[model samples]
Target: MPASIIEVPVVDPPLAAIGTSDGDEAARIQARLIELGFWVSGADGDYGLTTRQAVMAFQKYMGFNDPDGKVDEPTAAALTNMDLRPVSRANSGTLVEIDKGKQLLYFVIDGKTEWVLNASTGNGQSYTEPDQNTPGEIISGVSLTPSGLHNVNRERPEGWWEGDLGEIYRPKYFVGGVAVHGSNSIPNYPASHGCVRVSVPAMDWIWESGIMPMDSPVWVHDGA
Candidate 1:
């Protein structure tokens, strides 16, 4: 018998230009493409060749005369109209807040709150005698979390911590090493080398939530 034909259904792409591939939108597109028998290696919100091929295959299946690897109107429409299953909304919209004084990480989602186990802050003790009484005393808590608008600039799977100090594990977002990431252990006080410490679950939630847009606002504080 000849090789069986795996009947693949058609998928209409979204009507809207499917906004920039970031956060939830990217994840959704990736999932849908994979479901339609398209090879999407990973869902990182990047519209690469794999995603394009998937779109093209979907278009062909949908009976479109021009099944080019482009998410044109018809292709988008097919994907949008398909009877695709919905993904779970776990880690939908969560914001990360790092408190230096309290040494805590907060995940704000849907107006609710989820706190990480423990976190440490920068070293507040130990200082050299300022040039033999040149200055009275160096102030503590001088290095506050640089307050400003920032975002998840970069994300690394492994091999990030080679010449790093302190206790921080998977460092995902690197805003000058002041990232919101996972750690081996978190203390209930300032102890980090200079990075925000969060739990693994919390880190994963941040990644999945897709709320932290590029150049998002990040507010760091001493204490309320």
Candidate 2:
């Protein structure tokens, strides 16, 4: 008699991306992200803007290219087995690290990057814009995200603020006239004038959670 052959089963990879509304899949992804300390607002079974932004942040943290917030096979696989997390440059302290080169922000707790976010820093371009502080006065300077050690000096806890350049949401001022604020447009690369821009929801979370309190050390570096 001939030997019997055993059948092997094939498994399919997860498929979810921007605009995908599969509740189960979306919830799974969101839960995984939250478990990894990613800020997804909540796992509400909706792959919406907040979820997409969180996915983008995860991709950037993993050093993936073209982080388009697509949870395809590769992205899902990587997410499933992800072990690497951003390391804090500071030896030991609770601080916020702004990586200019990576355009990523890290919430470091005791030298460990507990959470990460997609951030848009300065674009390094010269510009002249109306200064909100002074009427009919224009300010001229380079749009540069200054790299140095600083601390959170002040913060606007509620509502949008009319900054020198434009409206910033819940800005946490660190350096002189520079802050880590919220914006609707936080591109992959640097785009802000001088402030570090994150999502509005993220800024809200920062304030509501009291993660970055007053005088919290903020280290801005080029990651070089």
Q: What is the C-alpha lDDT of each candidate?
A: 0.49, 0.80
Q: Rate residue 120 of model 2 by lDDT.
A: 91
**Residue 173 of model 2, lDDT score:** 93
Off by over 4 Å in 1: 1-94, 110-117, 125-144, 208-214
**Model 1 RMSD to the real structure?**
18.2
lDDT of 1 at 159: 31
Q: What residue pairs are clashing in model 2?
A: none
Could you give candidate 1's per-residue lDDT for residues 70-188 as a string of tens digits?
Answer: 66655666676676321111133445555554444444444333322234555555433332223464322333345444566776645335423333445655467566666644443
lDDT of 1: 0.49
Per-residue lDDT tens digits of candidate 2, residues 79-183? 676644445466567899998977888898766667778899999999998999789999999998889999999888888978889999999999888999999
Q: How far is each candidate from the true structure, as Cα RMSD in Å?
A: 18.2, 8.6
Q: Candidate 1: count the clashes.
A: 17
